[model samples]
Target: MQHLLQIFILYLFILKIFGDNVDENFPQYPETKQLYETYDFIIVGGGSAGCALANRLSEIENWNVLLIEAGGEENKRLMDIPGLALQNQHTYFDWCYMSEPFEEAGLSLINQSICVPRGKVLGGTSVLNHMVYHRGAPADYDRWENVFGNPGWSFDNVETYFKKLEDVAIDSPSLPDYFGKNGPLHVECAEYRSKLYPAYMAAAHEAGIKSELLLGPNQIGVECAWKTTKNGYRFSSNRAYLVPIRRRNLHLKLNSQVTKILFKGNVAIGVEFVCANQTYTIYSKKEVILSAGAINSPQLLMLSGIGPKQHLAELKIPLLKDLPVGQNLMDHVAILGLQFEINESPNVVEDKDMQLKEFLYNQTGPLSSYPAETIVFSHLSNGIPQYEDDFVTSTYEQQNHELYHFSSETWAEAFLPNNQSKGAFYIYPVLFKPKSRGSILLRDNNPFSHPRIFLNYLTHPDDISYLVMGIREILRISEQPSLQAFGTTLYKNKLRACKQYEFNSDDYWICQIRHLSTSLFHQSGTCKMGPKDNLDAVVDAELRVHGIEGLRVIDASIMPEILAGHINGPVIMIAEKGADIIKQFWANRKVG
Candidate 1:
């Protein structure tokens, strides 16, 4: 214990020194003079999509592009450490927005409001996310084309863009050729290499689940997730797509908060922003693309007079076009902190000594891997009456959807007040596609104040029902022979709120889920993209704003429907495809 304390102290000392020299290590942006200058393309919010767009658009030598970010560079040593990913929340790089108190959802939180963390730095959420690189199911995309009226967004059409952005680090020759071979982003299976992983896989198989580790578009089995990491560091969008490329055509403005979109009638002309405590306006001759993520994107739109008319009238803001800017807000809400005790902690060769050596020498170790390594994607209901067509259909619109099971190391320090050294693991049951839809609303017309967020999680009874069923499935998995070999058992932590009901009963689990349910940080679908005539649709199939010209929303906010996977990868793909669409439109204009 004393040795561990010394190591920790040394770690903090190293971090302090490293933090001081951040500006010298990370990429330097050009100094900003004044803002109102005109550029051919002005991409707001230097996030995952914004970074990709800036990189891709700047490829055209003649086109002048400006990328603006609300937060400064993420050069902190903490951002580079993969294990410290969760710690970045509510920190300097995070927007740290909180959701409005829930009426129908979030029954368990302190004030019934959940914390929403968004990236405010150069790479946006990509710099702060869990680094899980999932592309979602193919059927998810087909639904976008067939049901949502987006023709070019089918799995086949968008796969090329997915391939174009990734450089797969995993050497699985036996797997299908869906993965990208030559791309800028570095993706690899985390090097956790725990013995518990194999046992978990075996347990799933014993329970009639033939699981396969997949990195491509399909996610039908149990596997260790592929991550956006190179070596032991977090491979954020800025690192993968922006840093290496030296483009003189692109100008990046850091700490620039866009207040409103400057518009003339229906056409977007420029943006009014605050930088270094000074206000300025910048015009875009071509288009003003919004990639400010799910929360800020919609808030910015509404602030600029492009949202629901009724809401805008209350604030006395002149309405540009009456559109739902913050409606259809969707996220993957999960039941987190489900603990299970094993017979003994698995043999992790060189827990401290080897870890420090490996990280220093080659940047490889358990620290390199994300805390949650294994994930199981399975349909909640098979043919059981409880999981029947009606129950399943009532849960979500997807014909076939899977619940995400995250098996992770459950450090007792996070939960237990007494024994902080207890060995345990966690099983998080995540509702991928929920029936309940929420909204984002303006708190006031103030651009600096955070918009009121309504993440109506588990509003539908079926959402809670699915989660209850997932608990049952987890219990069954624990009972499997493979898991039984480790003497796996649920960690019986006393829940003061759920003590009235019998432990492990349906009612008790339901109570626990409601109180503990929080976001997976996969917030999306506020500015929905669909057919222009659809009243709820904010953007069209081409990602252009409905009833507006020279404007586009090319971020997670524009997702017509949230995919059944982590959003970072798909968000990048949207930017890649959106950039191509912009280039094509320019070429056609020249031809005309």
Candidate 2:
């Protein structure tokens, strides 16, 4: 009886901290009672991009916009807490897609396949992501325009859209012109800073890398990462875009899965989806925008008979357009098992009940922040002679290498001790611009079934070598006097898989890199955007399918090349620009 009372009290405490107002008054699921047979625009997903698109497109008022999402409403109690970010993964809110077993990489994981967690809730992956808001380097967008022949996607052209969606709450003196004062998405640094944060920053400085804003003029240093949060809670796209516009002409349908796109000859007209155990067909008067993300967007296109001719024919589905619907898949891959032990204990939490009370009253405690403390972007080719291979030198010259520092207490709670005495953290070296590419293929004709994801990580020798060099750099940082002051030492537990090679040898690290490789969940470029002359181009520069009219893919799937940072910020910017492009296209037609 006492245990039950304790549980009840804990629930009340959580409710007190997060409050029951938003969840209690959240717009009803399937906001519209009667389904409209036709709408001016039909969005296929209510994800990060979809929510922004719904808000922007519905602003016209006359245009009735319908957003169909496969998942239900978000669980505010669990999702709003910044500290419970990873706890949301592999739950009912996640799609839980797994990559195919690799011969080289992910050998140590279950089934030798890595688990890819894409949010299945209303806010999509934004609800499950680490909330770090980072726009890629200016050169990244420049390459998108100059190298890929995208006319309006240069940094200069798209900079306004970046500002259009951001509302900066943190004080950044050097980034005065880069931030937007009034926007829906609130951007701020985490309130709770652990003792290890300063040590990590000092250690980076000791290694000759100074602290600078990651989104400022240059991204070649270290700094505290900014996040998409407001008042110690997550500010998801659903919260930022959909909730505020519930009274508008926007119609949202929850638990609706779009199975196929209806087309007339070469023009997209409507979509067939299932909701509440009944299938319905909805028509789009203007265009059918695909914001179903990299995985689902490609899967939906292929299931609707618009993919590779040979693959479609094999499935007995008639080919509509012979486009590369699911190729050139890119993601940021990071090496695991790189942990450092420190003598200094973690931030002391005296009493769990007191910590809860502090969070409930002041909203400043361990619960107010995610564990990712600082990020470092560096060029590895200049100093390391042994790793200065041709590919590494050229790629480093492009400035795409990124290293992340994370407090491992929250991440490795299952293995670590429960007390706050032991202190340890992780420094992950991420491969941002991978030369190796994978593909996505339909498992069968069923839209409900997950697509066969082939994330060919570390297939390229250059990628593995680059990661190895990054590990060496991390080792150097650990050896610095600033970190050594904390008695920082690399955890030297030898893995069974690499026992044959000498410990700390190059071969042992290479073997460990393959066995423990994992993804950062930034999958993109499945539906490559390029010029019409490019045969492998799935969508044109204007985001329209190459051969099909009145259809556009405006999500990460259309990225010609994945950027050098997290994709959430860029995805929102894409939707913002795409909405403007769409409004212009229709307005011009009316004028004509």
Candidate 3:
């Protein structure tokens, strides 16, 4: 009984210092005597970008900024623990969306669609995502400038903002120039050392893949994941940026479900929202910024009568501006659930109580490490297709398998599985820069309803061909000498949908991909940013909604194309840049 009591005391001490007690560090939101009638900025969706924008916009002293979130603060046990990353999905903190039935891909999934988990909490999806910190290849940003026709969005211009947001905790003395020294967001390579880490790196090297450091000029390589964790807990956008700066200038409204942006003529004037069964309208004096992320941002635009002409007309919505609000949806889809058996038992961080204790006491254990600890980025496309521009430009039907059957070199991101039990691990292969485009449409005109998300994944033949080649590459990696040294064996999950095909055959693997592939949740590009000439462009280079005044979207939805890696880092960078743009505009206006 004495031993048990001592253990309990130690556990409480650890949690107080590192776990539950960390909540006390945040400054409380100032009490408001009354709700202000207007504000300089009304930022919707207190998510990744919303939090950052709210913090930055409120820095202008008297500039009253209102940040409204549908979900509550990220104060749950599942959110703090790195091992329980996926446990947040489908919970109250998640919007728990489902994509519309895929016409070609995801043939075997439940309801023939994938679960689109958007963060409903204060931190947005930043609190929900696997904390792999990535900024994508330099060429990715160059494409944003050269290919997508957004001039200032080049890698050079955006690189500075990424550095501004990151406070790198990586100890690699040689990698200093590539990372920020004292930024607010804490980023470090996962600390928990595992046998699988070296083995995976060795396997990659043996497979002719070179190890490369990220955030530098070259980003493609197998390395310990750069994560947004510090002291074994998630350093979310809300925690890193909002909580510390909860000043009187910034007003945070929780559970405020925005139904529509209130627009008068062509300008966004205010927002109508519901909270606790009561409805209220909050007006924006200067601008209404939509940082509702990829899913909700476009959904709000459509609901506010800013979308395709015919689609809005069908819903009897009074069209404010006929823009492509929900087209050009792109996400990094992955073929996960690939398990491999090993000679030694995998690291057992799955134990909730033990992992919690370790995180509290030492801040260096399985709980301190990101689940997808190692990642490899490789190109599998044969060559650039002849109708590459046509593929990216064509309508969803015109850009189908008939136009492009993917050849030559394209990008694939490989991740080592997070599970640490049953003497096994899995390899998750994500199809980066997919040619396929999806759409988000209104289920009805109802503002409180969820949007019909149609992530037409693998609709393009190139998407499937690249994934097929990626699976072949994964198989080759599993057979490498380093993995073989650990008695590595592929754990083949027999799919009932693929029972017609023989196991391990190319056709069977293809069947498994269509049946079992899932989304990496890096959803983007619904509100694409392009020049005025571009018809599908919803927002301009400044993130302002086309043909609409005082409205701008500063979230993943404005990404012209998805990045080669995770979207969290890039999204934060976008918010930083967007805030600067808004500030610069306001400053110029004052001077004029």
Give the top-scoring candidate (lDDT).
2
Tens digits of per-residue lDDT for model 2, 22-99: 244345334677778998899999899999999999999799999998988976556667765655666677897988
Each prediction's Cα lDDT score?
A: 0.77, 0.78, 0.77
What is candidate 3's local distance difference test score? Answer: 0.77
Q: Measured by TM-score, how close is model 2 to the native structure?
A: 0.90
Candidate 2 has an lDDT of 0.78
C-alpha RMSD of each candidate structure in angstroms: 6.6, 6.4, 8.3
Worst 10 residues of 3 by lDDT: 386-395
Please report the candidate that would top TM-score against the real structure.
2
| Candidate 3 per-residue C-alpha lDDT over 442-556 given as tens digits, one digit per residue, 9 for 90 to 100 | 9999987889998888788888777777777777888999889878887655456667888778898778778666778899999999988899899999999998999999999
Deviating ranges (above 4 Å) for candidate 1: 1-12, 15-36, 174-176, 347-358, 380-414, 417-422
TM-score of 1: 0.90
Q: Which stretches of candidate 3 lie over 4 Å from their true place?
A: 1-33, 171-175, 348-353, 380-422
Candidate 2 stretches greater than 4 Å from native: 1-30, 348-354, 380-421
lDDT by residue for model 1 (132-238), tens: 88787777787888889988999898999999998987666676577887887888878766657777778777877666654554455677777898767898998
Clash pairs of candidate 1?
A: 36-281, 108-515
